[model samples]
Target: MTEFANPGVGTFAAWDYVVFASIFVISSGIGVFFAIKERKNASSRAFLVGGRQMVCGPVALSLTASFMSAVTVLGCPSEVYCHGASFILFCLAFSFVIIFTAEIFLPVFYRSGITSTYEYLELRFNRVVRVAATIIYILQTILYTGVVVYAPALALNQVTGFNLWGSVFATGIVCTFYCTLGGLKAVVWTDAFQMVVMLLGFLTVLIQGTIELGGRGNMWKIAWNGQRLNIFDFAVDPLRRHTFWTLTVGGTFTWLGIYGVNQSTIQRCISCKSERHAKIALYLNLLGLWVIIVCAVFSGLVMYAFYINCDPWTAGFISTSDQLMPYFVMEILGHLPGLPGLFVACAFSGTLSTVAASINALATVTYEDFVKQCFPNVSDKMSTWISKSLCIVFGIACTSMAVAASLMGGIIQAALSIHGMCGGPMLGLFSLGILFPSANWIGAIGGLAFGVTLSFWPAIGGFIYPASASKTLPLHLSTNGCLPLNISDLLSTQLLNFTSQERERSILAENWYSLSYLYYSPLGCLGSLITGLLISRISGPKHTTIVRPTLIRPVSDLFCFWTDKGRKDNKEKTPSDNDRIIRASAEKELNDVCIQESRKIPSIYIPEQCTHINVLCVKETYF
Candidate 1:
């Protein structure tokens, strides 16, 4: 009955199924091939870090996979549908974060020569700091991957009329199978393929929807008329959503958590051959992010244009607007053979890539930080096998969690809140390890616990005990329904709960829900830093020692010392006269600088004596 549907077929044609099957089979095969190779070159370091030779494409792909999980793919559109232009600003903080990682975090990590980035915490701080950080990351990734995988399964259930379990089961079997088989190598390569598929599937929907909506201009016009095109609301209020300052600062920290501290991202960089290549890989990741974000934003507009007059949620056709994109794809692109298959495959790929990457990274951390640290004599083969086994265990746990968790919240908000809860503290711990030399294990651990508790409080209501009457502010609405002074209280219980009919109607009034996602990271980092310092000061003990200035030198110095430490005898340095003479000569040579000044006058016009005089002046002043 639909204009887009074909006459001969009742639902999807055979070719569409074939196309979908072929893509899945091919992508799976590619993963299997890599798995075989990984098994062949099996070693603890190789399994954990691909022997440190990952190229930009694989690194970029894995980073993209881990970064742009299904939560992102599905949630960005949902945010666009609900908040209009604000989500664009919400997502822009990533650009600056990527820049920070490229210049600051990547160089330090690549130079450290460690398999897990958290090991740097051990080297810089202590075992307790490393363990605490690794534990939080593992916990966050499990929850994060669970939600990510769950969202797409829910989307599949809505569009195809399959049971949610069937969708979950199908996705889990495939993702778990490949990830357990391929290790990090398979995860990275498959992620590259998934990124391509994810972009294509969304763009297909975007193009089809755009065409159906009449044109790109018409789409923007509809959004503009609806007041969804407003990006800047120049109100200097802290409670206001999408402010420039919030986006720049809060957004920066949130991203710093992901790129600078999170293993899911940093592992890819650590896998590269050298820090230079790692930096290159990070920039390429940013460039790809720029393209991917543009595509995602366009897809959002396309959805707006397609559903402008007759919102699907209003008609009771789809349970939620998150279902809007999937419904659009099936209704519009189902007729095109292989396209639906490609689309689903793309969706599955994104979910699987993230799940696999998270599990592998967690497994690596568990083995190194917990297992090996506890049992120092474990053989390389046993450690590697233990990590592989843990990967299987983690995959099973994530799958179980995915099925158990009922629908939570919008993909973007849920992802952000989850990240915010754990990421802020993790970022703080790493920052302390890398930047603050005085941070001891007790301080690091205390700061981490405090940061986690503080960040977790807002997410799961007040921490320890509920806030007292004095601490809690009751909501009073203006005539316009806008609670001007504090919206955090209003948002507390109802964070990201916008699909309800009453809630949607409330959003139409002037009292729109607006909160900054950026503040989560810095708040967490600050929480960790302050708490750690306080704890360290209080728990001053004989065992706690300051890091030597030599040890706290730049990354280059660390590498130089690490590479040559064995050659330098630890015995007392009996400096000979020749040794002192050589040191003096080296110091003088280091300080030497040649200053040059050239006379512009023609040979006939300039005197040789004047040229020599100017040269002496230049040398005396500049050098």
Candidate 2:
């Protein structure tokens, strides 16, 4: 507790640097190991997809690390600090997200055996739809990587007094070095390693902090008294941020965009050794995400208890709420050897995993969609180099985008905003192709355009005219616990301005910019679906005769309720028994070892996650 040189700041120690440096060395070492091991292998597939024989456990860890990012580590706590514990609802929504993605999306992508999920667009519709979705994915990944890279850098810089750009480059360089060296395998393995680092680093702080603030009962009592324990709001108003409805409904759509369709996770899913392994990977990922979210939310409660009376920003101790976690870590964990460094490493581990995942995915889409099309005759030797080069190029681009992210307000909101605005449209595009037989390329492109416009209007408006939110704290923040930093006058003014801030938020709350960000993904997904349907019908949909049955997921097989009746009907429409056998044998040509060709009868495995979400058995027939 007395570790800080001053009341609010702590410095990094020699052991801290030693612990932090190990993360980079080990991460980069993985890349070097894979590069040497596979030197004789002469194809880009090895680089891009681990030869499609990647271990399922690492893929699951990579998926969790890729999606959680530093944003969840840093932002979730800050969110709880300012907005209460409503984020718990958002984490809970992943239960449904994983079920839908694992059962519906994973099967189709694994069966198609495409490197990029966008490639499915061309198979289902046309190249135009594929290109459009690819471009949107690229934009979303770029923006998100920027925010992820910047978040931890900002946190470390605020506490350590290190140059922010220095922290940014350190993260980008190490990530790029590993990713470019070993490709997807390196990225996956490093992500697995970092996942352990993240859990150990973050949880250490939570445990130590909870100890500093007394026992769990006393800690909960403090949070309850301060209103940080508020987790439910049944309000249906879309503009009211973080209500139960908004968190649950809006979070479901957001997770769908991330898990169901995003390239980062999809690449990992499709690269696994078998379909069963991929499904298992996804289930494990959901549990990892849930752990991170719970830790972060409780960490936020811990932060609020410590600063409830002091009001860090009002007292001029920190510039933003995001800094609170880092500052607290420095103060409480700095005295102990390696603890602060562990926390810093934890934050940056999230950045490295996320940035590397994005770099790999960006390279994947570029190689599969653009390079292959533009140069049809490129040699495997040269193409492998091209993919590696693309990783370096994107790694730098993401690093540079961190500058732009600096001005994008809170990292979590900005990252998710990009996800919803761009990812939602792409998710819709994929959903349209996978769900509806009548969908055409023209309609998909039109729908994507509409969805983007609908989602971005509020995002852009909010960027220009940021909305103010009224205070909802049951206990008012006090400066009584704060020591004089010699700015008594400024603190007094901030206290007075609090009411005016709330007033302004109320006025802006009526405008489009004030629309709760949670609604963005749903708006885009639904907009795309409706518009695509309208345009498709108007232009004339192709007959089901032209659509491949494999591309469209059987809806009845997805849910028990739908399957009990739907499977019987689908059987009537399915090809005769002999035709199905012939087609199944032909599809096994992909790889006997890489893909599973099983078509077992329905088996009911009611997972412990939820009651309604059933894990359907892989159908023996391709209905």
Candidate 3:
């Protein structure tokens, strides 16, 4: 049996609501500003990619804000507090990973001049592979949307008794309204603003918590003495969670999946004014994300120091570990006017930024990949409107999904694992297309299918039958400080009600499924790579020169023989010296068609989409 201190250990004051509501007003106002200011820019390109003229600073901040969603603000602290500062390793891993991205993947993307990263897939493999990757990205984004929205709402519900579904809907609707109205620029600008507020809230808590704890030195001393600094563990065990190797090695694949091929990241990286600006944005983004990670983890350490003698779970202050941070806020900052509101607003800002970015990316992908593919000649106004409409639809759909998923109780907690299961395969598929020139469409498709299958089998099993981490992380907390409060009710026995009749389901998962979630990326990536290579050999390696060498990453051809321009493959069907022109294109002025059409057949091909040809002869005349 357990006794809770109260339903909500921290209640909001009168000014808290006002402070929280202001973030919504300003965010929505920015959307209105951009909607009216850029009303003339109605093309889908302008709307979705900001005409590729966006400044790097806000775009960089937006990139940081999007990934540092409510999950990072809330979950990372919980992670650090429970498992120690091992979460810091993820930030460091992402740093090196970003450098890899900038050096290897970023150059290829910028050179391609693509609206969607999926477009690269088509240029490299074919339409089928591109469409498959797009669908997977969309699915990954939607499942993740529920998590961002639901986390802040859950936090509010636990701390202030705010309505969970109400907050979820409000958060989703606000994100949709702005994302659909202002498009990419609005989302970026709004994210930049919200990021500042989030920093303010974090700083306030950190500074105030430190003041209460005496000083920074004391803050670290308490954390060190409490054994919450276990960050240097270099254990080589796969089953153990949060080891140095697991984080850096697995984290490499995870961040690679996120920054290399993710549509939202791709759009922001390329939306900058130039290659220099784009690279600068990514570097700045690295700094911003690293700051948030440090703040969140340090805040967790601060929270631990405050309740070191009286663990909140044992003291009955919070029902679950997730509530630790929010409850700590109430205990320390509850009395201060508008401070609680500021913190809540910070969480809300995080949720809105993440959700809005995903919604905008969803609309972008839909317009580029689906709508344009179906109706290529559609007018710009109609296409842009359709993109906006998609923003709304995706927004509402995500909100509803979040609400519906709430009914699943604790099962919704596994959503991250579910989303992560896709990361490995998606990363693998893209890496194959970029680094390995020998991979074909058959291999790409089959490899993706096989990679996802490999990831989910163990991921899902571990969720259902969670391995006890007790031996790995023995309870290092006590409630001795609360003994005088008379509120302690320990669960001395964890349900002896079995009466020896249930047989305890004597099965355990010590096999492959028991592998740590951190290794999911490596498993999927390795599986996809090996399987794709084997399958491609059967499909005859996509015929060397069919794809331009620029589509492949730099230096990739050094070891890859197929990507060399001089490769003569039997699969290529080249025409002889007397080969006739299979296709010709001529453009004359704005009409994009050659004049004198009646004279000598003009040699103009009126097609934006065409099949492979033996040779192309183009003629152009402007008058």
Best by TM-score, which number? 2
Q: How many Å off is the CA of 571 in candidate 2?
A: 12
- The C-alpha RMSD in Å for every predicted model, in order, reads 12.3, 7.5, 9.2
Ranking by lDDT: 2, 3, 1
lDDT of 2 by residue, 480-501 (tens): 6766433456545655676576
Task: Return the lDDT, model 3, position 233.
Answer: 83
Candidate 3 lDDT, 1-623, residue by residue in tens: 43534434558878998999999999999999999998998898889989889878998899889888777777777767766887788887888878877766776676667778888888787889899989988888887787778866876687679998899999998999999999999999999999998899899899899999999999899889878887898989888766899888877877677777788888988787676788888889999988998999999999888878778766666655766777778778988989988988888888899899999998888788888999989898998899999999999988876855553223223444644588789888888777665577888899999998898887877766555544234236666675455333343332233223224333446556667777787788788877986788676622322334445542223332322332332122322223212222312331232232323323222222211221121212110
What TM-score does model 1 achieve against the real structure? 0.77
In model 3, the number of clashes is 0
| Candidate 3 TM-score to native | 0.86
> Cα miss at 376, model 2 (Å)?
2.2
lDDT of 3 at 508: 45
Q: In model 3, where do residues sit more than 4 Å from their true spots?
A: 1-10, 404-416, 469-475, 483-492, 495-508, 542-545, 554-623
Quote the lDDT for 522 in model 3: 79
**Candidate rank order under TM-score:** 2, 3, 1
- Best of the candidates, lDDT: 2
Residue 69 C-alpha lDDT in model 2 = 82
